[model samples]
Target chain A: MSVGASINARGLTKSYGSGEGAFHALGPIDLDIKPGEFVSLIGPSGCGKSTTMLLVSGLEPPSAGSIAIDGRPLTKPITEIGIVFQDHLLLEFRTAMKNVLLQQEIRGLDRAESRQRAEHLFARLGLVGAEDRYPWQLSGGMRQRVSIARALVHDPSMLLMDEPFGALDAISRTQIRHDLEMLWLETRKTVLFITHSIDEAIGLSDRVFVMSRSPGRIVDEIKIDLPRPRPAHLGEYPDFAAYTKRIYSVFEKLGVYKFD
Target chain B: MSDQIAPVTSPPTPAARLIRAGWLWSILNSVLSVVIFLALWEGLIRLFDVPVWLVPKPSDFLGRFLVDYPEILRNALATSVTLAAGFGLGVVIAVPLALLMVSIGALERGLYPVIVFLNIMPKTVIGPILIIWFGVSPLVSVLVVFLMCFFPVLVDSMHGFRAVDPRLDYITRSMGATPWQAFRYVRLPASMSHIFAGMRIGIVKAVEGVIIAEFIGSSAGLGFMIMRASSFMNMELLFCGLVAVAIVALIFNALLATSERIMMPWVRPR
Candidate 1:
């Protein structure tokens, strides 16, 4: 928590449509993520978790307030960050390796250098021999791994993951969570991960921001005390009871204790 | 044709099974079907003692087809040339127009109704209008085929271009990809399958368009040959000409199928 703020946002707010149909999509809340920190945003379906990620990534502008990344204002579209979306969104015609190289093409970086980096990343990410395979040929987990490789291929400082494992089966999700922990431990990049599951948020992050729905805003910020090399099964860990209990307590404050 | 495509990573089990049935089986199947159909027709015609001016006996049709084979080949060549020209031009022009229509709202608004209205009008009506403007020539035949081929390709390409997942564009743009880069890398490649769908239907329309043109106006193609046969009540020759037309269409379809396979190796041929 002592590290300098990697991403600083003050009074950040996003809304859609004019009066009557006007909808508050996101916050007017202050946020500060420390350097090399992993933070998860947990909220209901309409809680604007994705909108916050988009606003920070410069994909959308906040109606009021600003976001600054590493002390640099994100007033325009920038490539200093990478995002692994909920959907892998891999081009079907392309091979896994070529899809990773897509980051290079977008960044206007050297192809040979990016290919070498992609090879290393793919291998490190457990995609060694599957580089030649198309997205359809690979399993859902593999596609998500390829997407992770793509996000890192450009060597961006920050990674914004919008529930990248949300679509995967339980086994794949648990498996990838371990792999992601390994990835983060090695790279130590600033990350903002968004998910609906309280277990996922507490299982992965150093900090968890519980959000409320409708007029979405951060309602609680819990510094996760779960130890590193996180427990594979949240149910198996003794500390999970305390973390889950606390996250549910936040939800209960809104009169909603659903665990979906 | 599918074999010429790169070995797809996902094995297409059903398509592979169909292919394993082999060329010999396919040929025999078609030959058997054709024989049964011709035999039934021949039996009915002979039993009825139908006039030669009506449906001629298959044997008599074959004999006359052999005699007129040289003329049939020449007419086939003329029609094929015009059809190919029109179809090729239609592909080159319509696809770009389709892209323009999808990319620009103003163009879509101004030209869409005109395009739809033109497509709705009977192609036969367009043939005479083309003749009136350009005179009785091969150009009219080519123009008619082009017109027929145009709408399908335009519609299909537009569909393909818009068919790109909006998320793909969002991801590309969020990654700082310029509009042109997004179009080149994501939009265009994603649209290939749809564009090819258009080409498949467009090629068939091209065949019909060229024939209709020749039938109505031109005097140097298979359609003209049909006219000549009908005028003389040469039922065998007319049937032979019709057979030639069908063969030509089969060739076009085969050619298009191969091109589709070559261009879009990811798409399993159905």
Candidate 2:
């Protein structure tokens, strides 16, 4: 039996409070993500990108919208979705290996299998020696690596990353981006990454969804026809610059970016 | 570039080394001062022709206690047992009460004023009432000790639980952790320092509690021994009793400090 999954959202409206104190953070909009697609949501701060990711990950319920993952309505527990927040969010007391193994505990996988999977992922992510160390002992980049390893340990078909590398230095961010794209290419798991950087959206995404501020809605979707196993130097390419420029123009037109 | 490549392991600076050595020297100095104090005390008693009942020298106090060592030991054991029981009871009550305060805002609001009122009310004033109700028994002494030491533990634990990082709580909840799981994993671990802080204070207060209990109601502990010595104007025995209580309190505090170091090894030293 094949366990195939795709995420679908329609008329997804989220409003905080009611009556005189009503506030709409996100859409009465619709979104559909096909299986094995890398989609990036790019917008200004407070544009509800994080909220959208939360809603899609089944972490929060939509007020009016319905979400169906793998054609099944997302009412019950979802075992095949992994989420990464801006902070690595690893349990400080647990070792990096144990942190990765937590996904296995959550998914109710066997201990031996979980350990094997965690070890394999840790090694694959260049975290071999750091496995026994606690989160506090590791650097920021290493902690983020642990988070990615944790997300992949359960072999989740869908990965939701909310600015996963946003807190890192420029060098670490670029390196992680390269590694992430490589991982995505190898695994072909459906990924929804949210970011504020147009360059990042263009660099890593197969398709970028540009969102507007206030009541967040997808203003435009730009397809990047970038080839597989994307080179680190791809950012220097005219085509990549053109895609970023176009996205920036859309932000500028939406008055979200004031490009002086 | 060569300097950068070389792994340079620097030794402690002379100033830092001096400071580290200074602590040991100061401790030695303190011991010397204490010895001088006792010798002077013994000499003054001998020279001034002080009465044995009023101020028996350190030697006399030590000689008498050593000969009657078994009796003193028995009383010490009784005092220790009562102290341990009272301390244990206070811990058992305080931890859950702190957790309750942390969990229920309404309950905390309702109880805060009462706790504040009770904490300020003199334990000495309550002593007579407790003895009257429970009688002059070991049980009453233990109960007195418990009452005296309970609030510090409760207040400290409540502060610790409340002090957990809100961001960490948010992270745990977003990870699909249940409420109990969040408390167990995040809140409880984060509150450990605060709990330990309360425990350290509680232990010292527990010693005070035992003495207070013994003074007012019980007849078998150091407090009662001191009271008896005072009645007969036996200042040396009274001083001996006081010293014994100080030693016990110091030992308890040291144990707590050691345990805190073991439990929270990651906590940066001030």
| Highest-TM-score candidate | 1
TM-score of each: 0.89, 0.85
**For candidate 2, lDDT tens digit of each residue in A1-260?**
12225779998889889999999999876888888889999899998899888788776788888999888898744557677888998876577888888666644578898798788777667787777676776788888889999878777788889999899887778778888888777788989999977767888888899999979998999998888667767766779888878888888899987867
- Could you tell me the fnat of model 1? 0.36
TM-score of 2: 0.85
lDDT of 2 at B61: 83
Give the per-residue lDDT digits (tens) of candidate 1, residues A31-143: 89988899999888878899898888888888999889889888886676778989998999888898999888877889998999899887677788778777777788888
State the weakest 10-residue window (summed lDDT) of model 2 chain A.
Answer: A1-10
Q: Which candidate should be chosen as best, given lDDT against the real structure? A: 1
Off by over 4 Å in 2: A1-4, A76-79, A105-108, B1-60, B165-181, B261-270
Stretches > 4 Å off in candidate 1 = A1-5, A235-238, A258-260, B1-36, B39-51, B63-66
Candidate 1 residue pairs in backbone clash: none
Against the hidden true structure, what lDDT does model 2 obtain? 0.79
Against the reference, the lDDT scores of all candidates come to: 0.83, 0.79
